[model samples]
Target: MALIGIISRELGNLTFLVSLDLGSNKFHGNLPQEMANLHRLKVLDLSFNSFSGEVPSWFGFLHQLQALNLGNNSFTGSIPSSFYNMPKLETLNLKFNSIEGQIPKVIGSLINLRVLNLIGNKLVGFIPTSLSNASRLETLEISYN
Candidate 1:
């Protein structure tokens, strides 16, 4: 059977973790805030699960995060502004969720970002012009909102 239930707070004990992919599983519930302790994390994929609640803003603390995939889940609420603080972030995927509100202009601050996918959300408003500031951005998919 697929892994199910909330992630344990004990996961934060792995301070040396570099990558964690719990995607395409049946796991549900809010992400444990304790995960903020994973200071060395680089890749985190929690897609295609039943996870519900506002996307955690503490993700900004993961300074080493390069790729983040929280797509195909049940998250709701506007995109967290803290996400713009992750300087090393390259890929951000939040497709097929219940996220709402306009894409913040601060998103352009992720100078190293390469791929950004936001398809199938409840977002509204024109794509921000400041997105042009992300000079390194290569792929942008924001259709089907």
Candidate 2:
């Protein structure tokens, strides 16, 4: 069974943490804002959970993050523009959620991104052409909108 309940700020104190896999859990409620304290986090996978509320803008504080998977959750609201703050971000998976609104143009600024998945959401508006700026992009999935 998946672990349930809100995450704790104690996790943020693990300053040396490079990767965190909390996917496939029963965890619910808004993500801990203190997660922004994980400065060295490189890969954060919190997919396949019950997490709700807007993806926190403080996530931008994790500058070293590379791959982030928050797919298959109950998260709502538009993707935060602050996401662009992570210049080293490579894979971004926010598929299978209730998130809406246009794909932010700032996404193109994530030049290091290799995989981009936003499938199965309520998003509207034309796909941003600036995505072309992501020279390293190998896979772009936006199906099942």
Candidate 3:
């Protein structure tokens, strides 16, 4: 596995909005929590890797985040409740992983959410009611085991 530079912080000031495409790479390890510092980030794609560990709890602070894709990895743990604070989230893709736990109730607060994909995971329980609160929700896919 390769160790890549974490450039998330440099983009926090609006000089740049972070976007990562390390998908289909040989990179393996827990995702760095420093990524949460990318407050000005808009898009983040970290799919198709062997990355493991729980999703960072600080993600809720990303008020400017739009698209977030963390699919096809070895990640484990419950979806962070802090994510409910994401103010501009639009699309979220997190399929094919070991993520487990009930969908957060705060997810419904995301009035701008369009697509939320949580397929092929260990997560259990029926979809939460908060999902229905999404006035702009186009799709809510959760294939829990």
Q: Kindly list the per-residue Cα lDDT of model 1 for residues 17-66, writing each as its tens digit.
A: 99999998999999999999999999999999999999999998998999
Which regions in candidate 3 have their CA more than 4 angstroms from the true location? Answer: 1-15
TM-score: which is higher, 1 or 3?
A: 1
Ranking by TM-score: 1, 2, 3
RMSD (Cα, Å) for all candidates, in order, is 0.9, 0.9, 3.0
Worst 10 residues of 1 by lDDT: 1-10
Checking candidate 3 for backbone clashes, the offending pairs are 108-130
CA lDDT, every model vs. true structure = 0.94, 0.94, 0.79
CA displacement after TM-score superposition, residue 20 of candidate 2 (Å): 0.5
Which tens-of-lDDT digit does each residue in 65-96 have in candidate 3?
A: 88888889887999898888887899988899
Cα TM-score per model = 0.97, 0.97, 0.85
Q: Can you give the lDDT of residue 68 in candidate 3? A: 83
